[model samples]
Target: MEALEARVEALCEQGNALADLEDHAGALGRFEQALALLPEPQDSHPSTLWVCVAIGDMLFLLERYPEAREFLRRAVALPDGLGNPFIHLRLGQCAFELGDKRRAGDELARAFMGAGDEIFDGEDAKYLQFVRSILLPAQDA
Candidate 1:
């Protein structure tokens, strides 16, 4: 990682630690600060994906759906995002919460198709399970 990217990664890690401590506001601040260090039209930078995802996830946790959607959109526009199941999953969930059912289904389907067996085997296992339960049923409806 470049110096800035390394610093941003550290900040994001600190933010994650704060979130684990239930200090969401502090986490959000760290995420926002990390995001601010990147250039606009951020898809050019590989690091932008993680920063955007971090900020978007934090905003989603804070119930700022619109803001979350914006940041997550930035994430999905990055080159790495095309193959990222987690990005699609996050966008799908955000779209669901925003009452955009069609978009939610589209994103969720992409996530399901793109993901490997191990995608749901980590820290986000429960969330992926919940998403599968909800979105899979929607597919049949």
Candidate 2:
């Protein structure tokens, strides 16, 4: 079998490149491949939270909300205080898309709080703002 670290690194590189190009389908594929190579949940492989976050991000981009939720939920369940705010952000997005306004607001708020200044860079931040300022309020009405 290939070295797990090398395989994961290669897959991550490919997925990132594909995501940068807006080729979400290809990115999802690469991320799924990486997820497949990841070791099962064990005390030794604590990096599974990171892997789950990565996969959840791609799945969210692909509009696979249920799958994204599954991955994000797993990442959130990790006991290591290594919480990934991005996963919550993506979960918020998925909840928003599914029209769960209350849950979306809560999740998004957590994401914004958790992400701090890091959430202000790309379109992700823009969308998060849009949801916070426009979508959620609109839904509340």
Candidate 3:
């Protein structure tokens, strides 16, 4: 089990590096491998949260909407995932892509409201902008 844990950690690190390099396909594969090594029904494991989010986001980048929704849903249900505005933001994006307007609105609102006045910096900031542009206008209508 320790050996597997080490392997999972290594794979996650590699996946993150790949993602940083914009090799999303390679990142997805590494994350998938790490996820498989982790326990099943992974909500209890702290390590599973990030991997799930990585896979979910990668799948979204790949335009696999339903799979992205599923993984993001799983990620958000994990203890470490709920407070991550990125998870909510990604889930909203996935919902929007899937044409689930109601969910997209709800999730985007959660993400935006959760962000408060803090200035997001990086990809998250972009996601925040997307939420504001798309969801805030709907609020007026």
lDDT of each: 0.78, 0.74, 0.82
The numbered model that scores best in lDDT is 3
> Rank order by lDDT, top first?
3, 1, 2
On a 0 to 100 scale, what is the lDDT of residue 115 in model 2? 75
What tens digits encode model 1's per-residue C-alpha lDDT throughout 4-46? Answer: 8788888899999998997878998998888888776556877
* Clash tally, candidates in order: 0, 0, 0
Point out where model 2 deviates above 4 Å. Answer: 42-44, 79-83, 116-121, 124-141
| Ten-residue region with minimum lDDT total, candidate 1 | 116-125
Clashing pairs in 2: none
lDDT, candidate 1, equals 0.78
Q: What is the lDDT of candidate 2?
A: 0.74
* CA error at residue 47 for candidate 3, angstroms: 1.0
Best by TM-score: 3
Which residue pairs show collisions in model 3?
Answer: none
Better of 1 and 2 by lDDT: 1
Ranking by TM-score: 3, 1, 2
Q: Write the per-residue lDDT of candidate 2 for residues 1-141, one digit (tens) a residue.
A: 358888888998898899899898898788778877777653246556676777788888788898888888877777652345677777778888888878787777776778764664564565567556743565634
Q: What lDDT tens digits, residue by residue, belong to model 3 across residues 5-98?
A: 8999999999989989988899999999999888865667778898899999899888898999999999998887886877887898888778
Q: Against the hidden reference, what TM-scores do the models get? A: 0.76, 0.75, 0.81
